[model samples]
Target: MLIGVNYHYIRPWYDEPYPGIHGITPEVFEHQLKLLGRVGHFVGAAEIGEALAGVRPLPDRAFVVTLDDGLREQYEHAWPILRRLGVPAIFFVNTAAIAERRVLGVHKIHLVRAWQPPEKLLERLGQSGRSGNGGQMGALSDVSLIESIRRRAAAHYNYDDPETACLKYLLNFVLEPAVRDRLITECFEEMNPGAESEISQRLYMSGEELRILSDMGCLGSHGDDHLPLGLLTPVEVQREIERSVERIEAWTGRRPEALSYPYGSAEACAPPVSGIATDLGIRFAFTVERAGNPDLRAPLHLARCDCNDLPGGKAACWEADRLFEEIPRREWYLDEHVA
Candidate 1:
């Protein structure tokens, strides 16, 4: 059986009480690596595939490391550390973000960080409305104002743009560049200091960086647009999958036979629509949902444990072992005939 851990960011000043905010801290990450080294063989996604195929011996304790979002922090922080530890990990990147060199759906996060009172930010966002343009701020019912801001922010940041229309309008009317930059950064830090610069640099992996990581046996596709599968039409899902595969293939000369679902779950992994992997000739696919190792029969719906969910950074190593052991017992019960 193969155990895997999913990671995104690694925080520096990880307070144990916080568990590094979202998940493990860089300190905890280091600790986890050390623990994993003692207990298991740290394999990459490809090696895990080979072992599951019975082409290689499954180590007494084998686990794979996988990361999503392809954040710059992964490049700036996790990559060097993983290299130093000599552990191979997979990073999944969305094609559009990298190609465009901008982050989608993050300016609000930045604005929230920069603005004074949360109320003020909300007011500015409310004034912006659904259009990216600043419109007339009539007497908006509270719900209307809130909804309008959300829609506009999603549109502005959810694609390939950085600055939201409200941000542009605010700058035009009030603040200078230095003050604006400072306010934005300050607000971001106030809201989430750990993610300030990291959020701003949420740019996707460049083609050159992708190649380098691929050459080093890291990097894979998260998807073309990073849209959640269940939310998209079947036709849209197919296009998302195909476009990602084509783009990766064009860059690497080798089609990526593996994929990670945007927000993977049983419903999202269901037949026909979810079977895009098998249809696209993908050999393996991963999900965010917690489950045991792949059943071999359902190679396309492999399970991965998120490291962020683990109690301590190293706790996942134990949890992974327990889950691996239970898979056989669960399979046996399922296969047993009932009286």
Candidate 2:
């Protein structure tokens, strides 16, 4: 089976009482890598993307490692570990943030919430008119409260999405670019004054650094603006996807073959995206929906497990390991609404 593991941040983690935002720490990640090294043939995502029928069948334990988003954390903390362990992986990036030095919609929300309560931010958006309490914001843990505000207030924002993800839609799609940028800048400045100049430098890797990593492993597309492709017009989608490929190609001296969807879920891997990938010569497109690929002759629409959801224990390493096994039953998601 061909499996891909999806990871984002790899920062230091603690057993905080509340469900504070967390990711696998570098130490734990190395433990997981040790498990993978023992049980599977870990391959680069690009090689997996290229392994069509012309190649022999991959071992049942074969897997690829992938990191989503071009967070500076990965380029700093995770890459060193990957290099030390000789573990190859693909790092998918959003070039717009790199090029324009702007905060992503999610990060914009995060920066605000980091300093102020979600209720305060919601009040700022004036989403609920009152504080965000009606949605049970107070009952929820901090992380959950963020979702509460985003999802419950989405209706007021007139976003069509049914989940907490509507905030992304509102921030990235509903609001005009200039308007959203100003909001993010204002929020950022309030929290960390005089930090505007360092936002891009602190948040993402430089192009020269990316080119060097490409030489080490592979660099792939995660769109330019990092918005949901299904939500954009066909022309806009083309601009986002094509420009990412062009920018990465220009920097790395090779057109990227892999294109992991910007959220890598929902509309992230659907009609317009697949069509764009086909047109632009993207060999593989990844999704967050977890599954094992029995056949990879055509690498589009491949499933990946989020690192947070990655299982543990020695038995978890077996060929029939339940985590990697048991492909979750999915509806014809392509036909469903981008919820």
Candidate 3:
């Protein structure tokens, strides 16, 4: 079976994690990579499109490693490890974040979660961020407070769009855009005062850095702003994909052949999204659908697995992986994140 796996963050083992962001230690990631090396034929994401187009056939254990979001963490923490291993992977980027030079509301939420107490932040947003996850947060335990906030956010974070669910609901839908921006900016100021020009750059890879990765692996579009395309207007969706293709090509010279939906799961692919992608001549599309992609005909809506979910027992894990596409991914993400 051909499988796809992805990651979002990697951090040092002993460092305190920033809240609202999930990370695996470098030790864990390396272990997983080595495990994958032992079992699968590692390939880049763009290659899957070729297999799908019948240009080539995929090997039994063909797979790709993809990193969504052009985070600095990918460049700082994940890049060296990938480089050291001589692994071929894909770094999917959302270009509007660079074009606009502002932090996405979701990232801002993470930053605020790391900077302030959950209690205070919850109170700021008018929700009780406390959770009954059997943990108590004292005023002095910032880590505990962060966990509490995270638990609360997870309770409602249905998908990766990070808006209209938990903190996203309050920040993205409830408050006006300007209001949300001002509030998040104010919260950002509390942590970092007047040092705003490079916030997005600090958080994500620079064009030069991404271009370097392009030579090593491949670059693909996550979206223009990393927002869910299914939730956008047709024009908005087209623009998001088109602009990302343009910007990434501007950086790397070749246009992107693959795109993974911003928060795509199996249920997240809209008809218009596929329609637009076809119009753009995009070759492959990926979703966090947790399965093997053995079929070549259906390339635009391909499935991917989370590497962290792959271990525990190879026999049982392999058996269960096939069911991922059969199961609707929205409910899976909801149950996993909030249930």
**How do these models rank on lDDT, best leading?**
2, 3, 1
Query: Candidate 1 clash total?
Result: 7
Put down candidate 3 lDDT per residue, 1-339, tens digits, no spaces. 667778877677434343456567777777777767776677775567667667887777766888888887877887788779877788888887777776776577777766565556645654212442212212314766545545544544534333224454445433444545666777887777765557887888888887897775478889887666766788988898999999888888878888888766433466567778868878877877766665554567777767655652222245334433442233332232211
Give candidates' CA RMSD values in order. Answer: 10.2, 6.6, 8.1
TM-scores of the candidates in the order shown:
0.65, 0.78, 0.75
lDDT for 225 in candidate 2 is: 81
Cα lDDT for residue 14, candidate 1? 36
Point out the worst 10-residue segment of candidate 2 by lDDT. 155-164
Predicted model with the maximum TM-score = 2
Which stretches of candidate 1 lie above 4 Å from their native place?
11-24, 52-54, 106-202, 314-339
Give each model's clash number: 7, 0, 0
Summarize candidate 1's per-residue lDDT along 138-248 as a digit string, tens digits: 333467654665555454323222334444333322233333444454555566657634544554556777787877767677887665564567787889888887888
The CA-based lDDT of model 3 is what? 0.67
Which of 1 and 2 is ahead in lDDT? Answer: 2
User: RMSD, model 3, all Cα superposed?
Assistant: 8.1
After TM-score superposition, what is the CA distance of residue 323 in candidate 2 from its true location, in Å? 3.4
Candidate 3 lDDT trough over 10 residues, lowest sum: 131-140
